[model samples]
Every structure is written in C-alpha cells, then in structure tokens.
Target: MTVEQNSAPDTAQIQLTPDESIVLFELLSRWCEDGKSPTPEASCFESTAEGAVLHGLLADLAKQLIAPSKADYDSLLNGARDRLKGNWDFPTLRG
Candidate 1:
C-alpha cells in the first residue's frame, strides 16, 4: 500500500492587538497549567500534536507579551479585558 503525503506548510500567521494577545496568553497559560500530566511519558495535554501547537502558541505569546511577566499583570490583564469589552459586543450566553 502506498500513502500520499501533503507538503503544505503547517504554520499560520495571525495579527492581534496587544491587549487581545495578553488576555489569550493568560487563558492558554492557565489551561496548560490546569492540565498538567502526572506521568513523565504523557505530555501536558491529552493530544500530543494539539498540545505541541498550543505550547508553541504560548511560547510565541510569551515572547510578544511583556505584561504577563510584569508585577502588575493582574491589573494589565483586567485593563486589556476592559478594552476588548469596549471594542466589541459580546452576546450573553443563553440557557
């Protein structure tokens, strides 16, 4: 049996405001921390490929976000959230 492999690039580029990026980075970081693996063999997530992608994204965000590493991160993040809320309308979830 022969298998065909696609050679398309596996990377993507996205643009986000600094506020948005910081907020998302905080969310992702918390998610990763909550999903820590017990066994050494198992990675931080259930799926290795997806986990790797998330980790890479987190790393990228870390490089781009200075607020997360600052002493006033909570205040910075809250300000970001407030700015985002003002910029866009988010529909409330319905039961």
Candidate 2:
C-alpha cells in the first residue's frame, strides 16, 4: 500500500480497506471537531487555493481507506495514528 502525490490532477492515489476507511473517518471527524472556524493557514480547510489541496489529500485518503486490500488499510491506519499521535497537541481553533 502506497500513497503518492503527483503533478497531474488525477495522479494522486491512496489504497486502503473498509475498516481503514472507518478509522480514517473517525480521525478526520476528530480533527473537524478539534478544528473549527478560523483555522490556521497551515491547517485551514476553507481557503480557496489551499483548500483544494487539502480536500484532494483527504479524498485520496478516503479512497485508500475504502480500497479492498488489507495492506492498504494497515498502511493508512498506521500513518493516520502516527500523525494524530505526533500532533496531539493541536490548539483549539475556535472561541
């Protein structure tokens, strides 16, 4: 299971499984909860230019999680868990 970002619009790809999708969704939901309005530039999901990039990355992650391969699922789950663990101190973005 490998995720790659390409210059081409349709080239970015991710591969995972149903269980992985559930995990990814849960993590994203937590982020959405932790991250509300007035998001920082680095993490904002509403910026016109950068928002598209963020959305694309998220879409790829969802696709990978929905893939049928167990390896893909494990890879995405591990990556997401590691990311969440490393960034556990994300500041509250809302009042």
Going through the candidates in order, what is the number of backbone clashes in each?
0, 1
CA lDDT scores, all candidates in order: 0.78, 0.55
Local error of candidate 2 at residue 55 (angstroms): 4.8
Tens-digit lDDT track of model 2 for 1-95: 33455443565456655445556565554444456544445644455767565456566666754432555655766676665555446666351
Instruction: Give the clashing pairs for model 2.
Output: 16-64
* Candidate 2 lDDT for residue 27: 54
Error of 2 at 95 (Å): 34
- Candidate 1 wrongly placed segments (more than 4 Å): 1-6, 34-47, 86-95
For model 2, the stretches where C-alpha displacement exceeds 4 angstroms are 1-10, 34-95
